[model samples]
Target chain A: MLEAIINILSWLLLLAGGAFGIIGGIGLLRFPDFYSRMHAAGLTETLCAICIIFGLVLQAGISLLTLKLLLILLFLLFTAPTATHAVARAAMIDEVEPVLSEDSPRLVDYEDRP
Target chain B: MRDTIFLIVLLALLWLAISGIYKPAILLLGLASLVLVTWVVIRMKIIGEEHNPTVFAWRLPRFWLWALREIVISNIHVARLVFRPEQISPRIVYQNVHFQRPLGKVIYGNTCTLTPGTVTVQLTKSGTVIHALDAKSADSLAELERRVHWLEGETDEVAAKDAGEERR
Candidate 1:
């Protein structure tokens, strides 16, 4: 029973991870601009990678494989965001004018105020 | 230095954990290596009591939860715009960041890059430079800074407490 439960959990985790990766890939391909694509890439790195790693751990049945999987997860969690931050910061410094949502706070007025 | 030893021990423990082989002698060696590494890391100012595992034990999960939510929302938003390319308005923007530590700065810089539609081009002590595919991404990066700043603030507070202890 326990083994069956583990198998089910592993499958679920794998599916979730794959779904996230697919969405991210689609977002990368379809996004209008570079920044949007970048956002998608970051999403895949953390969400997709994490889910898949977790799934693999379940399937590996508690051994060195699990530990290695954990290490990869740890490394990804630490590095992915840092990489994302670097790219965005570089883009902004280059003076990329970002698309604004209609409801986005008006910067001109905010700066002009008091 | 003690840091070198600490790093070596960390590597060995990681090896044992991944290998899942718990022989008695291996266990002793791992522990001894860890102790030596701890001593080295302390000497080299690489690891300390403040930024210890105990602190990360509390902080990392919280960070992951927040990052996950941000990724989901951002991915969906990017997908919408991708399907309709008309939404793109590629441009560059500058924003101010208030991170005091180098680690905080790196975290902020890399996070921006990892997100879709934005890439970090330059980073300095004052703030960051980014190029976004659209205004939305730029705005998102700006908003992200607020969160990073908040996290940095927490780190600073902890570091300050550690510093105080050293002085005493």
Candidate 2:
């Protein structure tokens, strides 16, 4: 019964991840600007990858493959945020302006204070 | 001379194996081709440490792991955008490439393209042109580059060595 429960849960997670990935792909294709599309892709990478890998782990039933999968999970955790940060910094260094909503906080005023 | 024959033999073997038909005569032919290609590759010295097959052995596992972590964090960020709507600051930007080799440039460009919100609009000897989905994604790409550099064993020493080689 416990194994069955775990199996079902992992499957659900995998499905959720797959859905998010597709949504992200769609967002990347449909979004108006590069920034929005990136947000979509980045999100998908985290959610989808985790879910699928989780499901795979459950199915693999504890082996070398599972270890490798976990290693992959750890590696992604470290790299993704750093990569995202770099891309944004690069954009800013290039003087790309964010598309701000009307009520967004102003960074320019903060910059002027110094 | 040996390398050329080896390559041809290898290709022929690969073709046979991939064909997937169970024929005794075909199997023999495939084995023969494999031997021929190995001979060629060995003679030509086409396979070396620089072009070693084993070098990229870890890339797939590493890539998968990287993808997983990216998904979770980005999910949270996206959720914040959806609910709180404060974190997202979308933008498009372009940046220059610093890598010298075509392979490095292509790998860097393609990797960004694989990730969310970044696309390779153009690549030139001068630099790469990227269309980032947002400011965050753009920043991510830059970070990814640093990580890639680290993975490639790029260091100050390596850069200095390259410079020295170029001066000669």
TM per candidate comes to: 0.62, 0.50
lDDT of 1 by residue, B79-162 (tens): 566567676666655666676567667667666665555666566667655656667667777556656655654535534544
- For model 2, residues A1-114, the per-residue Cα lDDT tens digits are 999998898889889878777776766666554445556666666667777888889988777677778768756754764566567556645755555434333222212311
List candidate 1 segments past 4 Å from native: A1-12, A26-37, A58-64, A79-114, B1-9, B22-57, B133-136, B153-168
Model 2 segments more than 4 A misplaced: A1-9, A25-30, A33-57, A60-114, B1-51, B56-64, B75-90, B156-168
TM-score (0 to 1) of chain B, per candidate? Answer: 0.65, 0.54
CAPRI grade of model 1: acceptable
